[model samples]
Target: MATKNVVVDLTKREKLDGTNFDMWHRKIQYLLNEQEVLETLTIVMMRPENGNTAQHRYDLETYESWVKKDHCARFTMLSSMHNDLIGEFENYPNAQEMWNQLKISYGGTSATILRALTLKFEKYVMDSKHSMAEHLRTMSTLIRDLKAASNNLSNEQ
Candidate 1:
């Protein structure tokens, strides 16, 4: 089988600092999906214990493929994160563990965070001194954060 050479360019994207997890998560997930390695974030493949058989050889190949993909996924993830965050995640044995730990650390919203986000969204006002584009961008960011915190907004909101 011919292997596909995927080039991931994360230079244009913002590194995952503590404050931008939602946007970083969305971008990284899309990158991993495009690389066809997103499954490595959730699935763990094991090497076959038995040897010298056709099934063992096939399983070994499958496991190898998984390893290759897992490495790519892990590298892409690490490359997209900030330097300060890398040390916390670099030692994970597999992409799945790293991904899970990230989700647990940054994905889960505590009640206090949710409330703060909601209040910010509700009280936001467009500043007359700022350009409309800047105001819109700020509003969109607030909306994204609120959604990430599991606070759904209606069209009228």
Candidate 2:
């Protein structure tokens, strides 16, 4: 059997501070998926009981595969987090639990944050002095922020 080796370069990526969970979550998800390890964040594999049977050996191989993938996924997540946040998450026993804990801690958009994002989008005006590229980049960021805050706007808007 052939194994796939994936090399991901995260040096250019932004670390996940407490304030950037939405963007960080998306990037981490993409990286995990690319490595074919994203399922480790959602599924738990049980270790097969020790036995002499061939079936047990096959099960052990499957379990070990899960463990390897889980470790990769967990490491990738921790590497992308800020130093301050890493200490809080590094001790999790598995990627699934760590992912759940992160969501519970930072995934929700509060009413105030949502409102602020909406207001910012509504109030943004392109300054003619800036280049069109700059204006487009600012607008794109505002749109992304609003969407991440759960204020989903239609493309027609």
lDDT, candidates in the order shown: 0.83, 0.82
Task: Give the runs in model 1 whose Cα sits over 4 Å from its true position.
Answer: 1-11, 110-135, 150-157
Model 1 deviation from the true structure expressed as Cα RMSD, one decimal place = 5.2
| Per-residue accuracy of model 2 over 34-120 as CA lDDT, tens digit each | 888999988999899889899999999999999999998998888888788999999999999999999988788777667767777
TM-score, structure 1 vs. true = 0.71
| Superposed Cα deviation of residue 48, candidate 2 (Å) | 1.4
True-structure lDDT of candidate 2: 0.82
Model 2, residue 76: what's the lDDT?
Answer: 85
Write the residue-wise lDDT of candidate 1 on 67-126 in tens digits.
999998998888878899999999999999998899888887878767777778889999
- Assess the local accuracy of residue 120 in candidate 1 as a C-alpha lDDT between 0 and 100: 80
